[model samples]
Target: MRLFFKKRSTFKLFLKLTDWNNLLNSLTQNVIGIINSTKDSFTGDGVFENKERLGFLLKTAEEKEIKILDVGGVSTKPGFKEVRYEQELKRFNFFISNYFGKFKLSVDTMNYEIARHALENNFEIVNDVSGFNDLKMIQLIVEKAPKIILVHRHPNSSDIQEKMNYKDVVKEVRDHLEEKIENLISHGVDKSRISIDPGLGFGKSMEDSQKLFDNLEYFSFGFPLVVGYSKKKFAQNLEMTHEELYDHCIKSGVSLVRLHIAS
Candidate 1:
């Protein structure tokens, strides 16, 4: 399947060469998947030196018919070190070229250059944790691709506990997501192809994260909602095993989950 983005005077056009309607029709239930790469990725899923393990995980996901497989080289966890563009590109190229088409691919990156590379390699989606902090990333997606996932996060913030200063957590997250949606629409990203994620542990206290989840329905923004709470500190607090946490996230209306374990 191939997707094309064409820009005209006013609105942009998204052209698909495959039967997208059929594909969507086939996906009747919400999906259960995993985000399989990280560098101190909060949940300890980052395996920079273990490329073979990453490939094995992708193989297992394919065998299980997982709906989405998010591959990210950079860790967005608090106080994470920034990765150079060249290094990210190399890692992305290696992963995609070796494991492309194993499953639906969503590249987790905030850098426009990395996003562009993922799209050029036929990745189906771009997961930006910075909530569109980089304008070039937005422009590339608007001009070259239609499907993208915008996750809310403050670029200047660090730890989740320290970033909790919202008057109303739910309202604040909803408003920020609304702003992102408007920005994408203005820049020509098809509203139909956009999704919203309220960065679960990105910069929210455990209590704040709970409030956001409790009020998730209020911030749907007329788009599909994705929640990434797999193996997070909050989930771990439940004292459940990895498998239990995965199942819990699936049952909690999470469209896609970011998991460290393959199960």
Candidate 2:
């Protein structure tokens, strides 16, 4: 199904297409299927570089009736070097030209340019792992006010690195996320266009990541949360399957999830 989002004088007008209330009403019992459209995702599910046809994968996910589709162009796994801008846009544009209009789509990118392109070309949301650091990124969201998934991570580090140091992991996370949220609002972004992701594997240690999941309720901050723990080292240590962990997040009030498998 195609989504219709029109920009108007008001920010709330653009939110009409987020399937926003669907996220709210399904918080207790649903999953947002993720499709890593990149070449080298951490979980080995990326389809962009495989010999298989991308259409087959997209068709399969649609057949499964997945509610939302999130596509990322670059691997966020630690130590994966940054993708050049041209290459990133090439992957994103390929998928956008073919499959975006057919799903409740989210484009995952940290780059302002890619996000801007997606926003203009009808992608319904931006899953921003960089916390909207760029002024243009902030302006795009504030002006166009599309849905966004704000992931929590420090600005000082890359996507993958040594375990970050945090004195009080839970408190620090709340402080950091709150600051970013407030910053976006101060710069004119509507809070309703925002969703929170604790970013389990981005830069946190096993313990810190676990603590955030344990206290996931604390960061709700009146916004829907998108939780992802699949293939995480900390979750591996506990031996919980992806579904088990997702069920737990749902029970703990998670509104959406990012996954390696869209089906």
Worst 10 residues of 1 by lDDT: 1-10
How does each model score on lDDT? Answer: 0.64, 0.71
- Per-residue lDDT for 33-141 in model 1, tens only? 5554545566555545567767766666555555566778776666777889888876676676566444667888878888888888777888888788777987888
Candidate 2: lDDT of 137?
A: 84
- Give me the candidate number with maximum TM-score: 2
What alpha-carbon RMSD in Å does predicted model 2 have with respect to the real structure? 6.8
Off by over 4 Å in 2: 1-19, 22-29, 49-53, 155-162
Pairs in steric clash, model 2 = 78-160
What's each prediction's TM-score? Answer: 0.79, 0.84
RMSD per candidate (Å) reads 8.2, 6.8
Mind giving the per-residue lDDT tens digits that candidate 2 earns over 1-263? 22111111111112332446555443322455566767788877776754254676677655555556777888878777889999999888777666632667788888888888887877778888777777988888887788888888776664444568988988888888888888988999877778888888778888888888888878766777788876678888876665567667766766676654433
The candidate that wins on lDDT is 2
Sliding window of 10 residues with minimal summed lDDT for model 2: 3-12
